[model samples]
Target: MELIRYAFVGVLNTGLGYAVIFLCMGVLDWSPVASNIAGYAVGFVVSFTLNRSFTFRSKGPARRELRRFLLIFALAYLANLAVLVLCVHAMGLDGGWAQVIAGFGYFGLSFALSKYYVFAEGAGHRDAGSTGHV
Candidate 1:
């Protein structure tokens, strides 16, 4: 159920990410890294809200969750940036195309982090029988 919700959110986030990346790299001619960063910033707000409310149904305080979320996304950014670099330099893909490929791997990482580290079963988030309502 959580995975299903995450996938739904991922689709929306992916759309925003691709649009930002396209506008940055294809239109504004920004570097791949810059474009990726911009896309991530835009997607982060949406992802955080959905994951907190609908996905994990987190009851945690916003600050703690926000901090953990930032950390997870920081790792995601670095990992996806590496993927983008590899695709562009080694695989001979353009920046825009590389971003498309990187999105797949990044989504997996983000989902794992959300499920375990960020919105885990205890302390901050809701568990089995708890109302989990703040």
Candidate 2:
């Protein structure tokens, strides 16, 4: 299913992003903020590419989809941060646990936005049938 593919891409993106973040912080002596930015930059590109080609099988123009994807990603990320802050500061939850909760919010919003707005069928070009190919 499309949801399954999206989840698979999310997992891959998360793993790769964390690896980049840790590498930048530990090996390149980058600040946590800088490392996080670098990691997310990589994730942005990978998420778009995989979600477009693999998950949605969209034949839409890359530029158009990318612009919409950027917008959705920003909105979802802001929501994620808000959830994290609320959980940690208001609810007095541990930072790690709050991050986990925030991540679910991020994932749900991202998937919904991507499916309905960014790569919806007939948004630009028609999507391919479910061939399960990348």
Candidate 3:
């Protein structure tokens, strides 16, 4: 159930991101790289809010959570950019199509990293399962 909600949020974010990229590059005649940067910036804010409040429901320190979130997203952004460059420039694909492919390509890895690293709690513990000791 939670995973479904998380996936829904991701889909929304992805749509928002792709729309911005497509509009900036397609309608406005911007470079793919420039449009991609703008699209990523906007999507980062949306992803942060949805993931923090809904997906992971993080209750950790705000500053730390934000920092970690940015860090993880930085990596994801790089991966996304690499995919875009390869698919668009190297393969001579359409910019919008390239971004579409990259978006799907990076989704799973981004989710896993953000779940386990960005919004995680309790000093890096992953043993979310309980021992029923109390």
Highest lDDT model number: 2
TM-score of each: 0.66, 0.80, 0.61
Regions of model 3 farther than 4 Å from truth: 13-43, 122-134
lDDT string, candidate 1, 17-93, tens digits: 88998899999999999999899888888889888888888777778888999999889879999999999999999
TM-score for candidate 2:
0.80
lDDT of each: 0.85, 0.90, 0.79
At residue 125, give the lDDT of candidate 3. Answer: 29
Alpha carbon lDDT at 108, candidate 3: 65
Each candidate: RMSD to true structure? Answer: 5.5, 3.4, 5.9
List clashing residue pairs in candidate 3. Answer: none
Instruction: Compose the digit string of candidate 2's lDDT tens values, residues 1-134.
Output: 78898999999999999999999999999999999999999988999999998888787778999999999999999999999999999999999999999999999999999989998853323534643343
Compute the lDDT of residue 96 as modeled in candidate 2.
96
Ten-residue stretch with the least lDDT total in model 2? 122-131
Candidate 3 achieves a global lDDT of 0.79
